[model samples]
Target: MSPSTQRITVGELAARFLEQCGVRAAFGVISIHNMPILDAFHTRQKIRFVSARGEAGACNMADAYARVSGTLGVCVTSTGTGCGNAAGAMVEAITAGTPLLHLTGQIESPFLDRDLGYIHEHPAQLAMLKSVGKDAFRIRNPETALATLREAVRLAQTPPCGPVSIEIPIDVQKMKLDLPADLSPLAVPPVQPNLAAVDQLAERLLSAKRPLLWLGGGARGASAAAQRLVKMGWAVVSSVQGRGIVPEDHPASLGSYNLQKPAEEFYETVDALLAVGTRLRSNETLNYKLKLPATRYRIDANALAHNRGYTSELFVHGDAEITLNALADRLEGRMQIDPKLAADVKRARAEAASLVDGTLGQYVKLKNTLAEVVGKNLWWVRDITLSNSMWGNRAPVLDHPRAGVHALGGGIGQGLAMGVGVAVADAEHQLGRRTVSLCGDGGFMLNVGELACAAQEKANVVFLVMNDQRYGVIKNIQDDIYGSRHAYVELHTPDFAQLCASLQVPHFKLADPATTRDTLQKALAHGNGPVVVEVDMNAWGPFAVKFAGPPKKKEEA
Candidate 1:
């Protein structure tokens, strides 16, 4: 073919770039402004675009896809309103440090800065996107489109990764471009830690009698190194996002119960703490008031993350995987294992698990039933609800590094959309693995339309809705703070079974905890598409432990 024949439009080149980056799937809604790019994608047929009912759902799906697949999650949306709709999901992705590419379409080049009305125009859209994403860019010229996209992808995938947004004008998308013979995806190099800092961290680990390893989402890639430390008799605790980093079933793993009292007691026994890839966020640290060991050391990709939450005696700036590998290499065969310290870790692990399980009480049956029926290929996803706050976050056993995903930003409606994204990615990547999303009725109602998106795409997701018929957490808060005077918390739910029927999704209601396993089995039997299993929390009775808001005053006590 001639050089002219090899030429392609900017939109076509963008699609080709994504294909080169190994992106097999994307999520978005069709819009007039984005037609050129969508047309190119449709003609190429290289990437499967899962059409979403809303832009928010599309972005959430993309976020979850990145979390599960460890690749750049792609979402396409129109400019202005579509981008605005996607902002909340972008925030969730930012909080989770998910690598996501949000490709959006802007008005034609000629209509750039005019106050004259354009169908989907919003002033300062780039600024709005920057507020939500790690970075935002505009392709002012068709020649720079590919380079802009390359930079966006690189930034999104870089350590301390988050979402990146790029806007292409309609005219720019349509402009024809010469295809470069050597077009290749840009490679962002990983950041390496200072050798002196690594040595200092090793010295700290070698000297401690009772050492603990605290893993966070940033440490997910360092699982092998974390396991080595665990084998070296280091106790392991994880933030919720870091749940599967050490394998929750391991004897030393404390899972996501890091903020509880038993774990707090265990913290007192720790002499040195090796906190890696975690911010030790305020929520996980009991609003930064939870006591930690005196000699704390931190390993993170971002140098600025040091002393953000708790002060660390030493801070090593590098990728978690690299830093942990260095520590493992330096400390191997150099230190003596303390039998008493190992025993203490085992005891602390057991006590923490027992205390959490005991607090679940009646909810334990439901938890066990899900655990028994979910099998090994489970991705435990949850929404922000009373159950998640109480036990759901820490209850499930995740075997793989990316086996658990949730709205770490405390968003409510994202679980359903995220589950769809995860299930879609799982089907394409790890077939037969189930994505089970636990959501409350109130939260479920927030993005309920995404269930249709799941059904439309034939995603293998089972949404287990804990139907308490009210904002359970808010009700508890009101009950504690407002002298049991309930107002506006109760909500009348639609018949979920019928709603599922209308959306052509299989539905199951668990009114009795006794039938939980069987109901889950039956619901999951038809694995052709998404399923909704509603657990009637009211019929199961109140949770064993109640939310009592803040602590009471000493005088009141």
Candidate 2:
């Protein structure tokens, strides 16, 4: 308890910094700039170094781990292209509102500006973070290392949790430091929901004959509140990020709803929408086509606190857990659940689900069959691809109590990596739920290097591949807009099963869709570290609704 006892090296200080974050595993490969910090920490009982096959996979695995465990997940990577390759996964963690701390090796210190012949000049990492809605900093001086570490953990774990980066220059790591570990644990102000706003929101719902409670990332820990809200009897539509925050089978919930432009009937006539946590992203709101009487009552922590004028009609500046609880309290005191409203939500949900199923029936019939065999409450992480539209529509039974994370904007090649993170989280939290992720064949190859992370760390995630030999989304666009012209989008994919085998991963190939049911069941039920079940199929259109040969007019009279 003396000042002498407090002194620790910057490397040692960094380990303690992560330990303060309550991070048990630091997943990433060791590199020159980070070797000291990573090696020193290997002996730290509170934290262990998770050796991943590649840094990107390590970062992604950490991102998912953070979301699942509610602890700041950390990953280390070498700088330059290493950091750039991490961009896709970082964007995933940010858009999904998952908390993650990424540490990347800097180009020593001298090469930062002049390039001093340092192969990797990375002065642009902070810019990258800001662009992705993440916070980042560089530690050139060992003096500020503690402060920088604290900030990274603090911001990553902040409400609307997202990724944060810290670049450690070699100089900062090896510099003889005489500083004490003044590391205070990440201190975040308790986000208390605004009761006044909750009351007003309840007022609108009390009278809304067709009110809908559309939830998203902000509703992370408010499951009980969500069930209570359903008891008040409003319809709920979930966005991609909003999908798992509430139970999919909840009677009031209308599975995961995709771009309303594609399913216009569901939202075009709603009396009111309670959009919690969702940014009302264009994809979710059909490019802001949700004709809210006015921009008044969408509840999001960021919009409410900052741009009150542009945020929501009933602004509530707090996390979803707090806001939903307050709203639940208000509803308990005020509104009586009318059987009519409950019945209406049920009818609307069933109708929408049926219409959507009919729209994409061709594809969901296949994935749902496999998902059913996989069983209820199973966690599914989707990387953006041609199959995204169909799977999002199916809202495959969430076989367990866990959240799903995906990039808000369409970004691909992250499924394998995120699975590594989520699998790590699933194991760490000791949750009994099985984890499965759907990755496009294209995405799987891009991040397949991370398979070693799963191998080395033994993350228990099963990966299912929709192995159409092309970038399916682009193929869909070219097919629709270019008269089915074959462009540069087509791929002559290598043996996908062979590819997984090369990565030392056990894989099974479904050359035909007929075997998909049994293939997925075996993969999910497999006790191996991780398995990939690749389904070979051709690319389809963008949620193509097969009409009866004729293009119907907007108003067929």
lDDT of 2 by residue, 71-172 (tens): 788878877777776777687777777778888778767667773556766657668756764788888787788888888878877776788888888667
Superposition TM-score, candidate 1 onto the true structure = 0.96
Error of 1 at 229 (Å): 1.4
Worst 10 residues of 2 by lDDT: 546-555
Candidate 1 regions with alpha-carbon error over 4 angstroms: 1-5, 548-557
- Please list the residue runs of candidate 2 whose C-alpha ends up more than 4 Å from where it truly belongs after superposition: 1-7, 110-112, 123-130, 176-182, 202-205, 258-270, 291-296, 304-312, 359-362, 399-401, 538-557
RMSD (Cα, Å) for all candidates, in order, is 2.0, 4.0
TM per candidate comes to: 0.96, 0.88
lDDT of each: 0.86, 0.68
Q: By lDDT, who's the top model here?
A: 1
